[model samples]
Target: MKLGIIKLSVLITSVLLLAFQPAGKKPIKVYLIGDSTMSIKDTRKYPETGWGMPFAHFFDEKVAVDNRAKNGRSTKTFLSENLWQPVLNQLKEGDWVFIQFGHNDESPEKVGRYTTPTEYKTNLTRYITESRSKGANPVLLTPVARRSFDASGKIQETHGEYSDLARAVAREQQVPLIDMDKKTQQLLQEFGPEHSKLLFLQLKPGEHPNYPNGVDDNTHFSELGARLVAQLVLAEVKAQNLPLAERIYKPDPK
Candidate 1:
């Protein structure tokens, strides 16, 4: 009887220990929805990297970064093409959605993508509302600044009313706002006109095989520029004390 009792006690102890074991950490996902500036670049694009590419590496394994941003996609096209639905479907409770769409929306030349200020505000609100409904947080970011400079070398405001619209939406919805446009413009100003060229897709003729005639695009980011911009966004995340900040990859003490 004593032997049987001892066996029973051991079994009970094992069960108790198993029951008290620590649970595994739940995985958190961050969904990025924006334009080409934040989208992954094609292999042919080479040095024209996007900020989202490096943004994914800043997080720990427990965090998943799903960048669904596409090239030339404005708020209207993003929704019209039903891209947002897939993201909404996959979002679990506690997920985060970063919404940035103003570059293409503000271009009057692009009639199809151009969204009026009212429509832009409504679109942003819809994204925030849907995200909240799914128990997910939505962060609004103004479009990253274009590298435009006047003859006097002052940074120009390229986004116009769209950036303000995003700010208004963030205010109305009580959502977190990252003024990427302002931040990047400040970065450009500090770099000055000549030096700022390094941050963009400026290339000499035949310098890169991708563009034999060479390219001098200022709006797109080079690899270095993309990484810098991603770092800026990460800094904002930390400054805001966002929940995702906890998943940031920090180095162990030396």
Candidate 2:
């Protein structure tokens, strides 16, 4: 009887302690939806990296960054195809969705992917509204600027009108906006016209097996470029004083 009483008392104490224990923080998911700039690269792509891939490491375990951005997707194509719906289905309260689309959407020459200016705004509005409906917060981001320099040796504005539309939607919806276009332009300019080439997938012939012939693409990013851009976004999160900023872990030195 004495042993039974002791066990019962211990069990009751344990139960009471557990009952009074603080609940753990709820898991939050920050979804990244965009184009090649933020998409994950295949293993075969090697040095080609996406800002989203590195962006994931910026946070504590409480936050998960889902990179739903694809290589060649535009706002129109993302909506028209089977992408957005899957993400929408999984959204929970306190989740965040970052939507950035402009590169392919502005490229009318790319058949089936180009979204007109009106359609672009409509698509952005739909994403924002739908995310809010699901009790999720939505942030709008202008597409990261491409590395382009004019003869005057100044960084060129590449995202252009589509970026403007993104800004407009953010204002109309009162959503958090990360103007990556401007931020990256500043980054490139800081590196200057000559040094900015290091940020993109620029390679000489036989530099790597993937691009044996060489590539001069400025839209996509190298591994260094991706990591830097990801850091830029993280800084913006803190600059905007986002709730998730509090959860950012200590970043790696390298």
Candidate 3:
């Protein structure tokens, strides 16, 4: 009888331990919705890396950054591809959806994907609404500036109307905005025109990185450049009063 009682007590203890074990923690999901500049590309032939590749390092492992961004995809085309649909479905409360487009959005040369400011703003609004409906916060990012320079060594603002439109949409939707175009332009201005080329992938003699016949490309960036842009984005997240960002950065030493 005593042995049976001890066996029953052992069973009870095992059951209690199993019941009190803590549940596995869930990862914080961050969905990156953008274009080529923000997507990972096959760089075997090219020496360029997308900013999105390094962006994940800005956050901890608890934060899962799903880079849904693709090459040559505009805001309109990304949606048409049904990329956002799956992201929305998987998203839970407190997740963030970062939308950065406009590189191709303003390319009137590509009418099928090019969008006017009015249409761009409208599409951004819809994205914001959909994200909110799914209990996820939407953050808008202005397109990063291409490494274009003027005669006086000033970095030109290539985004123009599209950047303004993105800002307006962010304001209307009450979302956080990362003005990467302006920030990058300012950085390039500080570096001067010729010197700023260091951030881009330059081709050497008989060395064709992305293009053949020795290209003079200035649009894409190298790994270091991508990391710097990602750092800027992290800084912007801290500046924008995003709750999740608070843990990522320490107090400024200044």
Candidate 4:
């Protein structure tokens, strides 16, 4: 009888301990560090959608995506703007940050903002080191594909040298890489330039070039496009075998 009683107590203790163990579902925090392609939105009626908008949907409620990305920003400018500090300060172990830039980082006027191949890789290394120091993992993403096309119906990669630099950064850092530029290019080829244009934010008549008729569009994506890119990102995470990705993908229940 005493042994039975002791066994019962042990069982009870085990059950209680199990119950109190922080729900294995501790939120997996995520921070997005990128350019207009990944920027979070405001109420102001901008026609284009940033990929960050839909990325949050890929994960279960246990994951929080804090998109600190901005429009017309680059790796250098993002730091100059002091955006990384806020995310870095709050980052905890097991958290992840996605860094994608290079869109606006290619122009001559943007030289200070555009990191050359060597400098770009250096910046990425710093991000990785800093994030790791803060107990966060950094994921590098290549820039999104541009709308430029060739007569053969090819979606030209306009980012050029920057795209190569991004790939090198990922390789050198030994970080998970989502080749957004390459993936986007392939997807655009499947879409064809004319139809792919649907993915970009369209502008009304007589807007500025960036606004595309002053209507606000072109470089940015739409909600649907963002969601598609998010899906692709998930796929990339799986391909790269990142641990945090498992939190986002689970078998569907009947």
Question: For residue 193, what is the lDDT in candidate 3?
Answer: 81
lDDT of 4 by residue, 1-254 (tens): 99999999999999999999885787779999988888877656455678888887778778999999988887788888998888888999989999998877777677567666676777777888899898888898888887778999988887888878878877877877788889988988898978887787755675534454454355778777788888899888888788876788565897
**What TM-score number comes out for model 2?**
0.94
Error of 2 at 67 (Å): 0.8
Candidate 1 per-residue C-alpha lDDT over 90-186 given as tens digits, one digit per residue, 9 for 90 to 100: 9899999999999899988997999989999999999999999999999999999999999999999999889999999999999999999999999
CA lDDT of each candidate? 0.94, 0.93, 0.83, 0.81
Candidate order, lDDT descending: 1, 2, 3, 4
Clashes of 2: 0
Candidate 3 ranges beyond 4 A from true positions = 1-26, 207-212, 247-254
The residue-by-residue lDDT of candidate 2 on 1-254, one tens digit each, is 99999999999999999999999778999999999999999988878898999999988888899999998999988988889999999999999999999999998799999999999999999999999999999999999999889999999898789999999999999999999999999999999987888889999999999988999989999999999999998899899998878889976799
* Candidate 1 global lDDT: 0.94
Residue 1 CA displacement from its true place in model 1, Å: 13
Q: Order candidates by TM-score, high to low.
A: 2, 1, 3, 4
Q: At residue 167, give the lDDT of candidate 3.
A: 94
| Model 3 lDDT-worst window of ten | 208-217
TM agreement with the true structure for every prediction: 0.92, 0.94, 0.85, 0.84
Worst 10 residues of 4 by lDDT: 208-217
Q: Over the stretch 82-178, how does candidate 3's per-residue lDDT look in tens digits?
A: 9878888898988889999999999999878898788898888888999999889899999999998878777888989999999998888788889
What does the lDDT read for residue 243 in candidate 3?
A: 81
Q: How many clashes in each candidate?
A: 0, 0, 0, 6
